[model samples]
Target: MTAASRQMKLGAFLWATGHHIAAWRHPKAYVTAGIDIDHYIQLARTAEAAKFDMVFCEDAAGLREANVAIASQTSRSIGFEPISLLSALAVQTSRIGLVSTASTSYNEPYGLARTFLSLDHLSGGRAGWNLVTSASPIEAANFGSTGLRPHADRYERAREFAEVVTGLWRGNPDGAPGHDGQSFSVRDPLDLPRSPQGAPVLVQAGASDVGRDLAARTADVVFTAAQTFEEAKAFYDDLKGRLAAYGREPDDIKIMPGVAPVVAETAAQAQEKYEELQELIPDDVGVALLSSYLSIADLWRYPIDGPLPELPPSEGMQSRQALVIEQSRRDNLSIRQLARHFAGARGHWRIVGTAAEIADELQARFEGGAADGFNVMPSFFPGELDAFATLVVPELQRRGLFRKDYEGRTLRDHLGLKRPM
Candidate 1:
């Protein structure tokens, strides 16, 4: 296909019950979806049936909630380890890609390499790694660290960590000796056949400057959160611009922004569905969730009708902090409004509309230089996911904006990504 004729690549961003913070409480949602392997299997099968390029599972090193109080009100703390979950899904599905998020901060490069390589082999070249530097203080405490390593320091380690992991994945062609790096030293040969599509597709989700640079140098698929067309375009331009400096082409990296869609037969129905989930967010839960993402002082002290409080400096999630701040200011949203917004998609974009409307947004973003595609995050599991497949996929296919059927067996082929040499 010609460049203009290239179909958009889609992936399912599989969260516990759904992407919406309150999805677990929705009447139709599977509240126990996190622990239900059958739920994930069905979702995976649905995505594959919809010809989705991949199914992505994000992971956290510790309980993602702010405290036991907030944790009690939500199901964020429950889930399967991504690799184990994806490995199980591998045998049950044949076409959709399986991507799992794991922290480079807590993992050994050799072990991660072996795990993903084995996964790629097992799945017959349908594996990917979503590299992350553990960002939560709770995650730090679990690892016996007093606090998170400074952002810059963590990225430094991650840069070296990624280098070591990729080098290990590359293996020694001569099979003559071991490899050594500042972050990792491995003396054993991989002793495995090259996967059908080479190494697992390297995916990254960081948006900070250091993170972007690391992705430019290494990631084949870059997952991001862009709340608007302009910002998404800016990010697309900046990251693509960095490729030449790394001796890589712009096409080397595919940018897929996360979008949570609340789809229904009409705009009214869509909003009804969206509002139902929003209403499920208890005030305390909303405040706590937004506060965690802002990584500043607690938000409960701020007046609901007043402007957002001036945030304290956070060594936590810097990119998300800036996005939330800009959004609040630009939209003139009060603390209450901001809290609800964050609860919707954290920092990712949300589209509440008919299936055609959702497809229109994706098409505009893709052709408008804002994204190569989207990582579809449904507002509620099974139900919303089913809606998108039954309604939206056909709309895109009819418009020739997406695929109607699988054109290739491996995720790399589906995404038009080349095998790593």
Candidate 2:
């Protein structure tokens, strides 16, 4: 299909409460949704009703924040394990895909493969794995490591781990298969038969150089955090370009950037909503969150309105650090200003507008060849998700930019992605 004709695939990136850092603090958002199965079921059904290609759940092996000070202040300390949550969500909704995040740094290939394979079967072929190399040092500690693994080493292990997982997914038709890889040695074949769509879709959300290469080589869907059209296009072009070298076609992988959009009846109302959420974030909380995200020196040391001093070197989240720094320099934002800015989408594109306006932004990106689609990160849950489904989705449908209804049963079918042999 041509770019304009290709339907924009949509995935609801469901975070606890919402994508905004202070989303839980919002009056309309349910603060305890992280542990509430009913809340997730409602969200899933809502997205399914809107014909979303998938409902994505992000995970971290350890507490996301650095310390009890930040962790206690933040609402992110609590959440369900992704695989278990998605497995339960599978029974609650049909047609809408269930995509869950897991870390290669902490999980073994065999266990991950088995769990996802079972989820695909349980969901009737609507499961996707968002493969991530755990970035937090806290995650490493949970796995008995003293510190974060080197970036290159982590991706190396990930490459091998993914290979083993896919190899196991392609279990022998006649005989058992064995895999001996640098990271894992699997002597026994997977006992599970292929699910309806053959295997769970492979999704990756890494933007660093090593991460991008890994995504190009293995990801069926690439989730990204692109802030601008130029950045998105650059990433899209770079990723699609790498597919040829891997003996993969351009269409083999889909790039879906994370976009957190706030929708309302009018432009003013949307801006008001966006600002309201931003205002809820305490300066200290926002700055701390920004510091952790960029993994640079604590910005609290610098004056809130003063020019950002030289960023300290970071061995953590290089691409994100660059993105944040570039944005700060480009906009000449103060420390407090950048904190509030990051609070909304945590560096993902945050669009505040009406339904038609949101649709316009999505269509522009899709038609501009900056994105195949987007993983929509609503600023707040239930409320924001409902608004998008009720307001924005129809506009997209009207413009023929999105599907009116699910055309097929499997996730691959929803995304128009080919099943692997």
Candidate 3:
């Protein structure tokens, strides 16, 4: 697509309170957001009104932090289950897509396929699934597993899991002899009709090599994290390049890296707003958050003022760990400094500026071939989401980088994705 014709796709990444680690502590933040259905309903309506492509939700099967003290200080431990939350939001909003993360690690193909397909019909085809392999041990323990599976083994299961789900979604009716794989055995087709937009959009956020390959094979949308233009571009090109091997074109998939933006009427105000949130993060909470992503439990053992220690590869979030390590070394940041930095945005690219400045950065990335779009991560809910909608979105619309109004009813049309046969 030509530059003028290609508009950036945006997903409102909805988290309770906000995406920042210290969001729930912000005075303006609604601390009770986790239990407030009206809060999410209002946020969804706001995104729909702003013509966002979708509102994405993340999920985990268990507690986010293992340490009770650390977990108590933050709001990550409390939130609505994403699928249930989105199902509720489906009836409340009419336009924006509702996408939720579900794990292949803990769910079977037949059940997962049926659930998302039902959601697609309920939302009039505005449903998506963000595929993830449950990487955290805390989640693993919940399912009575002996331990977390190795990274490669998890992805292998995911590969088979995705194939079965997609086949079921396509209405495969051969049930006499059904799929019998290493991890799953299925004997019947899904007891559901074909999806309204052919099938609910398939989304993935695996950035490791194996993860990227899985995404290229089946994902319609890929969410990623990158802190620099070079990193984002490299990932965008690599993933898009792998598509041809699967008999798919580059345009077949959308690559939208997560972007955490703190926007205000002025640059100084935006910075001030970000600093205010930053100051709310406690030292232990910051370190604990970093440790969880790094897949290590005793990060607190390291000297806070010292540089990051050499570490083994992470089986949890390999891509995220690598990103954190790169940043720490490149900037020569100490443990405390790195923790504070990543704790704010959770390892995604962060931009703090006025509406025009935020728009300028997004435009450069979109037009510079670094991204097909962005999954916008607001620092706090309601207020920050409102700021992006009222301030930055109009600036993007004026430059023709984003849609000013809904031109299509389903998420497929909004994303310009082809309706699968």
Which of the numbered candidates is closest to the native, going by highest TM-score?
3
- Evaluate all candidate structures by whole-model CA lDDT and list the values in order: 0.88, 0.89, 0.94
Off by over 4 Å in 2: 2-4
Clash pairs, candidate 2, are none
Give one digit per residue, the lDDT tens place, for model 2 in 1-421: 7755789999999998888888888999999998899999999999999999999999998888876776776789898888889889999998899999998988899999999999999999999999988778878888899987788888999999999888788777766557777787877887788878978899998898889899889999999988899999999999999999899999999899999899999999999998898889888888888888878546788898876677776778888889999999999999899988987888999899999998999999999989999999998888999999999999999999999988899999998888889
TM-score of each: 0.98, 0.98, 0.98
Q: Model 1 compared with the native: what TM-score? A: 0.98
* Candidates arranged by lDDT, highest first: 3, 2, 1
Candidate 2 overall lDDT versus native: 0.89
The weakest ten consecutive residues by lDDT in model 1 span: 175-184
Please state every model's RMSD to the true fold in angstroms. 1.2, 1.2, 1.0
Better of 2 and 3 by TM-score: 3
Over the stretch 126-213, how does candidate 1's per-residue lDDT look in tens digits? 9999999988888888888987889998888888888877776776677733657666677876767777787789999999999999
Which pairs in model 1 have colliding backbones?
none
